[model samples]
Target: MASPGAAAAPRRGHSPLLLAAALLLALAPSPTTAAGRGVARECTYTLRVKTSCASPAARTSDAVAVAFGDAYRNEAHAARLPTTSGSRALERCGTDTFRLSGP
Candidate 1:
């Protein structure tokens, strides 16, 4: 028998511990990228702002903006900035109140 300090008895080809570890690593999967909270970050958290417009603002865009071959359309949306127009982006100061947008 080899002394306790000597090299461990050689196995046939592979060891059970190594096989088990390999199986565990293969089964226990991790995220490809650094996984964030299960919920998506861009999950439509409506941005809010307080402002006044001269009149009801209308949607208008100089150029056509399309994503994934889908053309965005504006219907009966009031508070939200249109697919073409934006509220927080267009907001500017005029006289007294902080203007969120213009009409």
Candidate 2:
């Protein structure tokens, strides 16, 4: 029995639920642990990645990342990976690290 214009309008009932979810997510604690702040012990790991192109001297300005996962799908990602040379020297990329929890 609704009019054409009323049927065409979007529903408003979900807005409050969405807003509450956003607020909860904003107030939730981040999953990352600082170097010495948490009770759980943490470790630092180093990974070396190599890429091959048609030209041996060619390099890319693209950002490189590293990720590893376990059988249960738990994953760790390193978004600030720096380029390295054959002699294990790091390129002049800035050092930054990011951490989050998800699949």
Model 1 regions more than 4 Å off: 1-41, 52-80, 83-103
List candidate 2 segments past 4 Å from native. 1-39, 53-57, 72-74, 83-103
C-alpha RMSD values across all candidates: 28.0, 17.6
The model with the greatest TM-score is: 2
lDDT score of model 2?
0.38
Best by lDDT: 2
Residue pairs in steric clash, candidate 2? none
Q: Candidate 1: how large is its RMSD?
A: 28.0
For candidate 1, write residues 1-103 as lDDT tens digits.
8888898754554322211001111111133423344531211122232223432332222222112111323111235334333433333221111112111
Lowest lDDT 10-mer window, candidate 2? 17-26
Q: How many backbone clashes does candidate 1 have?
A: 0
